[model samples]
Target: MRVSSYVIGAPLSDERFYLLLHGIRGTLDKVPARTGAFLVENRGKPLVSPPWDSDDRARAHLTERGYLTDLPEENERQLLVEVATALHDAALALRPPSFFFVPAYTCNLRCPYCFQPHEMHAGRGVYAKIMSHEQVDDAFRVIDHFDRPGALAEHLDLSQEGQGTADSGSVRRGALGLFGGEPLQEQTRDVIGHIARRAAERGATLRAVTNAVQLDLFTDLLGPDGLAELQITLDGMSDLHDRRRVGPRFRKTFQRIVDNIDLALARGARVMVRVNVDRSNADELARMNAFFLERGWGSHRAFSAEAAVVTGDAGRETLVTRPELVEVLDTIRADQESCLASYEGYAHGVLSRALSGRYPFTQVANCGAETGMLMFDPRGDVYSCWDEVGFAEHRVGTYHGGTLHLDHEAARAWLSRFPGAIDQCSRCPYALIHTSGCAKQARDNTGSLFAAACEGFQSYFPRTLATIYEQVESCLLGEAERPGPRPPTRTLPIVDVTHGRTRPPRDEVLR
Candidate 1:
C-alpha cells in the first residue's frame, strides 16, 4: 500500500486536528494529528508495514477516503486522467456551446494598464474591422451547425458506460456574449442590437463585458428582454477611476458610467461591477463600496460588486501580491457586509465546494474555453480563449463568407489542455482545484498549450486556504469540537507571476 499523492492537509489552530482534502475525490474531513502526520510522512512512499497495525477500522477509513491506494504512481496518474476525461466527455455531451462575438478590437478608452497594445485600439490596424450583418449570419450558421441534432454526438465518442449517450436533446441551448475591443460602442450599437435579437430568437441569454462608457447608447437594448447582464468595471472612486480608466481626449468617465449603470438597473438589467484592485486601488475598495451604497446600487437585487486582482501592464510596483490581495479582501469583508465587498476568489470557491459534502468532480480544464466556449471575432476568426483574440496565429478556426473552417489540430490542443496531461501538475496536490491555471498563460510562458500555467496557485492556495479555513471553522465543526481562535493570518513570500508556479505579472487572474 502507498499514501495517495492527492491527499493534502492543513493543520488547524488546535494543532491536534488537521483539515484534510482529497484532491481526486473532493472529500473533506478533519483528522487527528496522528492520522495527518502518518499520511504526511508516508505520502508518495511505499508502506512496508501496516501503520494501523490491527486497527482495521483505521485502515478501512484510509482506503475508503481515497488517502491510500494500492495502484502504482503511474497507474494512479492514468486513473486521474481517465476519470477527468470521462467527466469532461459527459459534460460536453450534456451542455451546449457558448459563443462570444467580438464586434471590434478597438476601444474608446486607453486604460494605461490595458493588456492589448495601444495600436489595437487605434481603429486603423487589423482590428479596425467591425462585425457586419454577413459576418453575424455566418457566425450563426456555424452555431447552427453545432446546434443541429446529432452534431454533438458526432464529436463525442460515448463508448464507455456512464459517459451518457448523446442524443438530439442531449445538449441544450447555449448562451451568447458580446466581447471587445469594446462591444458596446456608438458604431457597434446596431450590430449589438442585431446580436441581441438573434440571441432572443434562439432563446439564448445575451451578456456583455463592457466598460459601460458607451452603455447609454445601448439603453434601448438593455433590459431583461434584451442584453440580460452587463459586466462593468469601476476601478475605484471618481478621481482614482478616472485617472486609471481614462477615456478619449482624457474625458472624465466615472459619473457617466455610474449613470449608465443606474439606467441599466432601472431598466431591469442585471449589473455586475468589477473593481480591479492593485496596490494603488486596494485601499479604496471600501470607499468604492460606500459609493455603490450611496448610489443605492447595492439595494437592487440584481446589482452586485466584486473585487478582482489587477495584473495588467501596470508597473510591478503598483501590483499587490496574491496574498496581499487576500488580506485586503478579508479586511473589506470584515469591515462591511459580506455582500458589500465580495470577491469570487479561487481559494474561497474551492473551500466552499470542499465543505459542501457534495463530492464535486475534479475540474477537468481551466475554464469554459476548453469545454464549450468559442469566441468569434469581427474578422470572422474563431479562438478558444478570449485573451487569444486578435492574435491571428492563435485562432482555432476561421468563419468567413458564410462558410465555417476549423483547424481540428489547434482546437484539439485546447480541448486537451487539462491538469492530468501536464507534467508536475499531474502529481500536484491541488491539480484538481487549479486545473493547471490559464491555458493562454501556458502558451505565452512555456510556448505550448499543453504545459502547466500555475500562476501563483501554489503560494496563493496555501495562504488563502489557511486564512479562509480560520474564518469558516465554526461551520465545519460543532461548537464543542471547534478549535481555539485561529492564529494571525500569515502571508507567504511573493512568487513571481510568470512561470508555472505563478501568474503572468501583467494579466488579470480571470477566475
Candidate 2:
C-alpha cells in the first residue's frame, strides 16, 4: 500500500502502536534503501545504552509513545514541499558578501603556532605598512561592487514606497570586520578610520579583532557609539602566560587588556575573548572559565573557548594525543557547566570523541573555509582558512598589482571536494555530517584529506564514548557521596604559547 503521511490523535494504546508500526514499515518499504539505512544507523540508538535486542522492540517502543506513524502517499509529497519551503527560507536568512579588510601584517609577539612564522622573524623593528589613502579608495571600489548593485535596487524600492509607487523588500546594511598584523597598531589608524567612515555612509556595522594592546588608540575611529564587537586574545593567567607571550611589559599588557575589556563593557560595547586551545594550554581551560566567573564577565556576555588541533607547520607529532585532548575537553565541559546554564556537554563530548578517534564518523566536516569564514593576509591574499596558508592555487584573489578579484564559483568548487575526498570517510556513516576532515591537518600529516579524516575518526570515537561514561559515573558518585553545595568553579587564564623561548640580551634586561 502506498502511503504519504500519517496522523494520530488522542492517547495511544499498545494495540494502536503495533498497528502504526506495521503501517510505517509498509510505507517505508517503498522509500529508498539509503533512507532506511540512515534511520537505522545514525539516529536509531540512544548513546546511553547498548543496542536494542531487535527492530521489533524498537518499533514497539516508538509506537507505544504515539510518535510513530504511517502517512498517506499524498502526505509524503506535502512533507517534501514543506521541507523545500523551509530550506528556501533558511537560505534567505544568510548574510550576503561584505568584506574583511586586513590593513597590516606586523604582529607584536612571535607565537609558536602562528601560521605566519615569517612575520616573527621579521621582528618588532620592522613595521608593516598600512594601506595608503589611495589604497583605501581602491578597497572601497571593491566594496562598492558588492554593495551598490543591491543598494541601488534597495534605494529604488525605498523611494517607490515613500512615494506610494511600489512596495519592496527591506534592505539592511551588512557587516565589515577589520583584521591585522595587529590592526590596533599605531600606524593602521587611517585604514581603520577610512573603513569606519565608509561603513557609516553605507549603513554597515564595523567590527574588529585586536590583541587589545592599542585598543585605546582606536577610540577616535570607534566614534561616540564605538565598534559593534571587539575580539581580544588572552591566552592564560599572568605567570603561565607571561612565560609564553614574553615582551617588555608582559604583566602590564594583560592587565591593560582586562582593563580595556572592563571599560568597553561599561560603555555598552561588546567584547569577546578568543582563546586558542592547544595541547600545552588545554589542561588550564577550565581554570580560565573560573577566572572569568570571578570577574563577573562570564554571565554578562557569551563566554566560549575553542579547541584547535594544531595543524600545518605547528602540528608536531609530539603534541597532545587525541585521547589526551578528549580528556581535556571533558574537564572543560564539567567546569563550564558550573556557571553556564546552556553548556553543550554532549555535543562537545561527541566532538571530542570524534577528535580522539572513538567515533567512526567523527571526521572534520565543516572547516571554516567551507563555512564562509575565509582568511585574508596582509597583502589582500585570500586563503580557504587560516591553516591552509601556503597553497598557491587556493589564493583566490589579491589587492596588489592593480588586480583585485574573487572567483566565487572557484571557491565553491574547492569546498565541494571536502566530502567523498577520503575513502574511509566516504564509506563511514557520519561522512555526510563531518565531510572529509581538516584539510590542512590532512595535508600536513598524511598528505591526503581522506587519510587525515580516517585517522582522526579512529583516534577520537572510542575515547569520547569512554569520557561520557566516566562523566556520568562521576555525577552519580557526586549524588551519593557529598550532595550539598557543589564546589566552586575555576577559570584558567590563557597562556601564550610563544613567550620565553630564549633569555633577553643583557642590554634588554634590567639589573
Candidate 3:
C-alpha cells in the first residue's frame, strides 16, 4: 500500500486540522491532526511500516477517500487515465454544443500585441475574404447537419439515452459566437443580421467577441432579441487603451468604444469587459474600475470587468503570473476608498467554491476546443482552437461545398488531448484543475501539444487555497453570530462531476 502522489495539502487556521485535496478523486477533506501527520509521512512512498495500527480509523478513512492505494505506480497511472476518461465522457454528455464563426481574419485595428497579427499571415489574401451570404447559408447547413437526428451523438461519440438525441428537441441548443477579425464591424452588418436570424431559427443564442469600435452599428441587435452577450476588450484607461488598440491612421477610439458600450448596455446586452493586463497596464486596472463606477457601469447587472494576462506577441518582460495579477488587484483594492469588488482573475472561481464549501471543478481538458467545439472561418475551414484558426495545419475539418469532410487525424489529435493522455500531466498533482494548461501554449512553449504548460499552478495553489479558506471561515463565523433567525439552508444539487467536482459517478468510482 502507498499514499497517492496527487494529494495537495494546505494548513488550516487552527493548525490541528488540515485541508487535503485528493486531485484524482476530486475529494476535499478537513483531516484531523493524526490523518494529516500520516499523509505528510507517507505521501509518494510505498509503506515500509504502517503509521497506524490495522484497526485505526485514520487508515480506513484515508483508504476510503483515495489517499492510499494498494497498486503499483503503473497500475495507479492506468486508474488515473480511467478516471479522466470517465470525467471527459460526462462533460461531453452534459456540455452544450458550441460553434464560432470568423467572418474574416482582417481586423480594423492593428494592436501591436495582437495574437493573430496580419503580418504573421504574410499578406495571405485569406484574411481579406469576408464571409458571404452563400457561406452563411452553408454554415447553417453545417449546423443543420450537426442538428440531425443522431448526428450529435455520433459526431461527439456520446451514447443516446431515450429521447436525448438531437431530434428529440429536449436537449437545449448551444451558443453561436461571432469572432474575428472584429466580427461586429459595419461592413458585415447584413451578413451578421442574416446569421443572427438563422441562429434564432435554430434556437441558439447569438453572441460576439469584438473590440466594440463599430458596435454602434449593431445597436439594433444588442438586446434580448439580438446578441445574448458581448465580450469587449478595454486594454486600459483612455490614453493607454488608445495606444494599445489603435485604428487605421492611429485613430483615437477610446471614447467611441466607451459610448458604444453604453449603447449596448442600455439595450440589455451583457457586456464582459476584458482588461488585457501585463506590466504595461497592470497598474491601470483600478482606474479603469473607477471609471466604470463613475459611469455607473459597475452597478449594472449586465456588466462585469475582469483582468486577463496578456499573451502572444507580448514578450516575457511584459507578462505577469496569475498570482501577481491577483496581488495587483488586491493592492489596488486596498488603496481605494470605494467598496466595490475588485477585478477578479482566475482566482474568482476558486474563491467562490471556497465560500460555498464545495470542491473546485476538475478540468479534463483546457477548454471547449479540446472537447467538442467547432469553429468555422469565412473560407469554410474548421478548427479546434480559436488561436489555431486561419492556419491550415491546425484545420480539423472542412464544411465546404455543403458537405462535412473531417481530417480524421487532426480531429483525433485534438479530441484526445486530455490530462490523462499527456505524459507530464498524467502524474502532476494539479492535473485535475490545470488540465495541462492551454494546448496552444504547450505547443508554443515546449514544441509539443502533450507537454505540460505549468504556468505557476504549483506556485500559487497552496497560498491561494489557504487564504481563501481563512476568508470563508471568517465570513461564515460572522454570519453565524447574527441576532435574527438563521436563513433557510441552501441545498446544492449534485451537478455532473465534469461541471464541478461534487461527487464521482456511481458506476465509475474506484474502490
Q: What order do candidates take by TM-score, descending?
A: 1, 3, 2
RMSD of 2: 12.2
lDDT of each: 0.68, 0.44, 0.66
User: All candidates' TM-scores?
Assistant: 0.85, 0.61, 0.83
Model 3 CA deviation exceeding 4 Å by range: 12-17, 31-42, 46-60, 93-96, 119-124, 148-153, 156-171, 333-363, 479-511
Instruction: Give the clashing pairs for model 1.
Output: 311-506, 311-507, 455-502, 455-503, 456-502, 497-503
- From the highest lDDT down, the ranking of the candidates is 1, 3, 2
Q: Model 2 over residues 1-511: C-alpha lDDT tens digits?
A: 2111221111112122111111111111111233223333333233223233355666565444323434444454344334333322222222223356667666655555566554432433333455566665666665554342123222212112222212124433555666655667666776677778777887776666677777777765543244666666666776555555544334446677778777666665666565555667666567766777788886664333333334334566535544455566556554454332111222333433443445322223244343233344554566544433334466655554433555655454434344444444433433433345445545556754435344344345433433333344456668433211122121211111211111000010100
lDDT of 2: 0.44
Better of 1 and 3 by lDDT: 1
When 2 and 3 are scored with lDDT, the better candidate is: 3
Q: What is the lDDT of residue 233 in candidate 2?
A: 65
Question: Could you tell me the TM-score of candidate 3?
Answer: 0.83
* lDDT per residue (tens digit) for residues 189-295 in model 3: 88899898888887777777788898888877788667877777787888898998886743787888899899998998877666667788888878887888799
Best by TM-score: 1
